[model samples]
Target: MTATARPAEKPAMPHFSSGPCAKRPGWSVEALKGAAVGRSHRAKVGKTKLAQAIDLTRDVLQVPADWRIGIVPASDTGAVEMAMWSLLGERPLDLLAWESFGSGWVTDALKQLKLKDAREIKAGYGKLPDLSAVNFDHDVVFTWNGTTSGVRVPNGDFIPADREGLTICDATSAAFAQRLPFDKLDVVTFSWQKVLGGEAAHGMLILSPRAVERLETYKPAWPLPKIFRLTSGGKLIEGIFKGETINTPSMLAVEDYIDALQWAKSVGGLDGLVARADANTKAIADFVAKVDFLDFLAEVPETRSNTSVCLTFKDPAVASLDDAGQQAFVKAFTGFLEKEGVAYDIAGYRDAPPGLRIWCGATVETADVEALMPWLAFAFEKTKTEMAQAA
Candidate 1:
């Protein structure tokens, strides 16, 4: 029980990377047996499978019947970029950046898309910008969850129901695990590699009628890449929403996604997913509450993400260290756990403040998360002792 002593048990499964995260329990390559691997994605069977995936997604995620959901290329990044490039310059824009991914959107607006009317409302890694400052009169883009920082918007209460501009949200890390206010959002984007733990290289783009209306009515002053185009002859292309992807897609990945969605429905769908994530976060939060050494990176409890739970050292000795020292400490601490193979990829993002970020997504087992707490305590002490002796 001593701080220097290693825990007797290890997490049964320690695959806790934040993205391309742990697979659904009992998952295997066998699940993709029905994949239309040899045939073209346009074939009858391939297209039917793709359409079934879209239908199952709607069933499991409980997306509205009126919204258009499509499987897009390039994961969440592609979906966001498509939305930004297609719809943003029509009005002034508000870009919110509180973490690495959110900041990337800011760069896109200011640097890549080069929208002169874009305004960046930003906060540090652990906090969120003032919601009151958002100019809803203009188009707004933000991440529903800050995967890199372990923070999320508490809810959609801050957004008005009658907003004048479209709200484009990157919910890659939050979808299925959080209750999104779809009625308030014009566009929502996510990837299968996140909460449900499906394969990567694909993105899900969901658009409300307003977003589609904008796409059909307005053309950006700049050229549109074929990959990002959502319209043809000034009409919203209906085929894409029905599983006709812009380019060739990995049918194997689509099959895997369908399998995951089926699993989701079996477990009570979105509500079940959210419950699993909440339980996983509580396991870590309970440990943090009792320990003086660790604390959540998100300053506000409400804003703390249940899925990507981030932590920072609260002990004065570690907290007072410079950024480089803190990173070194984390390296050594995570090294011990990684060497044990009890935890991997739990280090804070390189662009974020020095801290630990753990994935508490639905696919991750809560029991495994509970098993990791003691190891975290042990590793922290072990690293501090070794570093002190070396110093």
Candidate 2:
């Protein structure tokens, strides 16, 4: 195949990173000029801003009124780890893992927490564990979306409504862009830097009434750190849910989040956010359908992620390469695109299969994704020629 001509137009914003994703449409530093800098987060104005962030999160996510939502430290990882350390030892746990992040939780449960009864239900990249095999009688830990592998749980139907245990979900990549069934999830965690395109360093933890009950009734055998403590004297510290953070917070990042939340609301909130991501993924799907070598890493369309869209080369020549060779190829492929200023951070995750990963979250414009398709084809053809000439 002959190499194609350079694309006439490029994406206006070339930020396609999976984390610290693209900023909301029309976002600017000017939007955060009102950040309450130099003021104590505990003070009236700072506290008001903090409370507003929490309130806006709840409203935009459509969280249940009774659910406790708090802004915690250490982004989504911290939130998920905190939930695991605080809640898992009390029951037999079932940990489902399909990708790096989910597998990390499994290791935390069995090695770090050393829970004797914890069972790992696992699948390789691009597939999901059997949801029917999950025991709802035991506490469950899973990721709503596998950011590395580009697979996601299909829906909440797998979770039994009248379960005997809690469901703790790491929804860092799924929230805002996906329909999360709050009633099915006991604890949900996400970072500010994901679908909403806000700054990092903080995580939002949402707790159903059942999760709170577990917190008050059951305490872990290990000592809890001040940062991870959700309860004191076996009583839920209700203030945290009301914007009283455990430690000082970045007011600037909080302000950025507020701006993103406002943008989310302006775009019709959750429904609109989901629609934008859906459109972005659809554009990529169309592109993949026309291209012979590129295909989704996710074998099942139903489980394919709309946010972190992962792709692999289908050509037997490229697919026949060893792991290191494939990695080198992807590195060169991504570097080629970067050099052209067509994309950035589109490399597949280090732990994932060799391929490309693109962020198609709500903040990414569909027109930009559409414009990017031709460039990908051009890059592939050009890269293939370079590899052949070298051989």
Candidate 3:
């Protein structure tokens, strides 16, 4: 195939990375001017801002009143590790994984935590595991959104409402863009840099009353890291839930999160955010439908992720190549877009199959994704021509 004509219009903001995703539209350095820098986090002003972030998060997410939300140290990884180290081992565990991040948790449960009785249910990159077979009587650990493979659970129908065990979810990529059933989830963890596009190095941990009860009632057999500690003397530490973090936090990041939350509110709150992400994904889906060579990585339309929208080259010539050759092709294809200033960081994750992963989070404007489609075609054709010529 010959190279297609160069796209006339370019995306106004060409950042499409899945993590540290594009910032909210109209975001600027001015947004962080109100940060309480150089001050003790224990001060009333710093704590006030921290509490405000939690309050706004509760409001935006519509979390249950009895649930506890806290700002934990590290990113989403820390919050998840904290939950696993602190809460698991008391009951039998069921680990579900379909992609890179989800698989990592399974490895942690087996090798690191050394949980002998944990059951592992896994699937290939594009598919989901059997949710029906998952035993709700055992503690369940899974990622709400498989970021690398672009597969997200369509809803919370799979989770049992009256399960005796807890549901620990890593929802970093789904929090703002997807509708999470808080009542169905016992433990949910996310980061500032995902759907909201805030600064990194901070994690948000949301826990149901049941999760807190588990913390207070059961104790892990292994040693707990100071940073992962959530309780004192068998009682839940209420201070962490009220802005008193276990360690010092970056006020700048907190302020940036506040800005992102405020933007989410201005754009019609959670409903608006979900709509914006859906529109962006719809634009990409529309484009992919017209291209014979390109298709979504997710085979099931219902389970497709609206945030991390991954695509694969379905052309016979492209798919025939080995994994190394496919990766080389992806490099050339994404490099073309990067050079054209139409997209950036659009390549699939290192652990995922060779493809393109475009973030369609609320922060990314639909117009930009629409503009990017033509550029995507241009790059694909150009790369194909170069490969043929080289052959």
Candidate 4:
């Protein structure tokens, strides 16, 4: 019944979908011009590019010398599954799940792997499971950051350095944008699509010395797929860790990944990436601080994610609504923003609590985030008015 003035500006680049996220600031089709297109991935040129990607990954992420970094198949999921299939079942497993991806791992450990010695520790959305309660003596599997829930373990302080069993971490969303504790983790898996915004299906797997020892000695009871096999003849497959992949790889995608890694070096490596993500998250935090109706889905401030920043309606009028109503509100709010071309794909994960999920990864510009904040408020106001009138 009354007209409202909208925000004067919008985000310059509104391509935030969480996974297969926004590309580098100056990226274009020309960035892939040098791709070894239609060439054999096993050839010298393709191998060189793949090796460069791995080398850049180590140099930029500061991976330790002894650690083995490999380009694997599938995205982060394939890498994580490869680790679980190759490494688990030798010892008792402690599976931890606080979000969807983590929960998928739990299902794999229990229902799929049928690990009778496994125990599951879980927490609801926006909160982390008890890190202190984790049995480090038993092989522990967890996600460093809960992408769907917007919760993350603050640091590696809770994990014991001298633990007997290995630590398998799905660091897909945490890699590049977050500081991973290499010493405390035995196996780490991520994909370039998250922070680097590269093409998907290419997974990166990093293994510690202890994990190598496990592969060399212990074997899972179940059979591993050909591509999932990480060892041969009681020894680790050294070639897999190198540029020689088990399965065929996309030279184009590999080249794009290398391009992204080169860009990462330009931006000052891991520290720079983390700073950029933090700045983007801060832009949202400042906006949330000024608003009474919206708050973080993550209950604890420290646990809030720097990448997949999830927000919820704290206003009683919205919070008191049932699940469907909450979902409807978010749909309306995000739809309004999308119609204005200020933001895109900011909806929370379907399994996550009804709310807004904005990707604040390093590939996104802080100026865009700041510009989009006012548009969020504007959209919310419009959605509230329209919904009320319809009611």
Name the better of 1 and 2 by lDDT: 2
Q: State residue 198's C-alpha deviation in candidate 3, in Å.
A: 0.5
CA displacement after TM-score superposition, residue 302 of candidate 1 (Å): 0.5
In model 2, which regions exceed 4 Å deviation? Answer: none
Candidate number with the higher lDDT (2 or 4): 2
Q: Model 1 TM-score? A: 0.99
- Cα lDDT tens digits for candidate 4, 281-385: 999999999987799999999999999999998888789989999999999898878887888999999999899889999999999999998787777778888
Candidate 1 Cα misplacement greater than 4 A, ranges = 1-4
- Cα lDDT of all candidates, in order? 0.93, 0.94, 0.95, 0.92
Residue 377 displacement (Å), model 2: 0.5
Query: Which regions in candidate 4 have their CA more than 4 angstroms from the true location?
Result: 1-4
What TM-score does candidate 4 get on C-alpha atoms?
A: 0.98
Per-residue alpha-carbon lDDT of candidate 1 for residues 1-391, written as tens digits (9 for 90 to 100) = 4545678999999988998899999899999999999998888998999899999988877889999999999999999999999998999999999999999999999999999988999999899999899989999999999999998999999899889899999999999999998998999999999999999999999999999999998989999999999999999989999989999999999999998998998888999999999999999989999888999999999999999999999889899999999999999998888999999999999998898999999999999999999999888888888988988
Poorest 10 consecutive residues by lDDT, candidate 2 = 1-10
Per residue, candidate 3 scores C-alpha lDDT tens digits across 1-391 of 4557887899999999998989889999999999999998999999999999999999998888999999998899999999999999999999999999999999999999999989999999999999998999999999999999999999999998999999999999999999999999999999999999998889999999999999999999999989999999999999999999989999999999999999999999999999999999999999998988899999999999999999999988899999999999999999888887889999999999999999999999999999999888888887888998998
Cα deviation of 183 in candidate 3 (Å)?
Answer: 0.8
Clashes of each: 0, 0, 0, 0
| lDDT per residue as tens, model 2, 1-391 | 5668888999988889999899998888999899999999999998899999999998999999999999999999999998999888888999999999999999999999999998999999999999999999999999999999999999999999999999999999999999999999999999999999999999999999999999999989998899999998889999999989998999999999999999999999999999999999999999999989899999999999999999999888789989998888888889998998899999999999999999999999999999999999888888887888887
Candidate 1, poorest ten consecutive residues by summed lDDT: 1-10
Report lDDT (Cα) of residue 23, candidate 2.
96
**Residue-level error in angstroms, candidate 4, position 278:** 0.5
